[model samples]
Target: MSTDPAEAAILSTLAARGPSKSISYAEAAKALAGNPPDDSWHKSMHPIRLAAQRLARAGQIEILRKGKPIDPDNLHGVLRLRLKEQPE
Candidate 1:
């Protein structure tokens, strides 16, 4: 479990969606902010992105742009997150 709420929320949200599905930063932020999420949820976006960068670098998650995985360090524009595929 991550000490960071954003990291935990991101992981849990993606886990709930399963490996084949992905979610946007806003989605993760809303999840972190909780259901019926308020405007304050927007505040979580940067931290969510940061946690996503860390997770992607660690191979715990994959970052996508234009529906394809891209360099985690080059994150920009709209991005999505999904669990990294597991070997069969």
Candidate 2:
């Protein structure tokens, strides 16, 4: 399915903060909606997580668990997204 909006939001949010930052999927959702988390915020997650998976596969980002990257396809429990490498 088309996950462009979420994909763009994820990358933009990360790029805007540079490689020193990371973003949770919920943050991606809120960033995409241009608002804070609320009753409607959960609605944004599915698309955002899917976009996370795609971005992870493209090697443009990483899916982190316990401060380290994990396999995007096999993820479980809480996670966050960060740039695959730090800025030098």
Cα TM-score of candidate 1: 0.94
- Which ten residues in a row are the worst by lDDT in model 1? 11-20
Q: What is the Cα root-mean-square deviation between model 2 and the actual structure? A: 3.1
Give candidate 2 regions above 4 Å deviation: 1-3, 36-38, 86-88
lDDT of 1 by residue, 44-77 (tens): 9999999999999999899999899989899888
In terms of TM-score, which candidate is strongest? 1
For all candidates, the clash counts are 0, 0
lDDT of residue 31 for candidate 2 = 84
lDDT of 2 by residue, 1-88 (tens): 2349999989988888776588888888888887655677678899899999998999889999999889999989999898788465
Worst 10 residues of 2 by lDDT: 33-42
lDDT of 1: 0.93
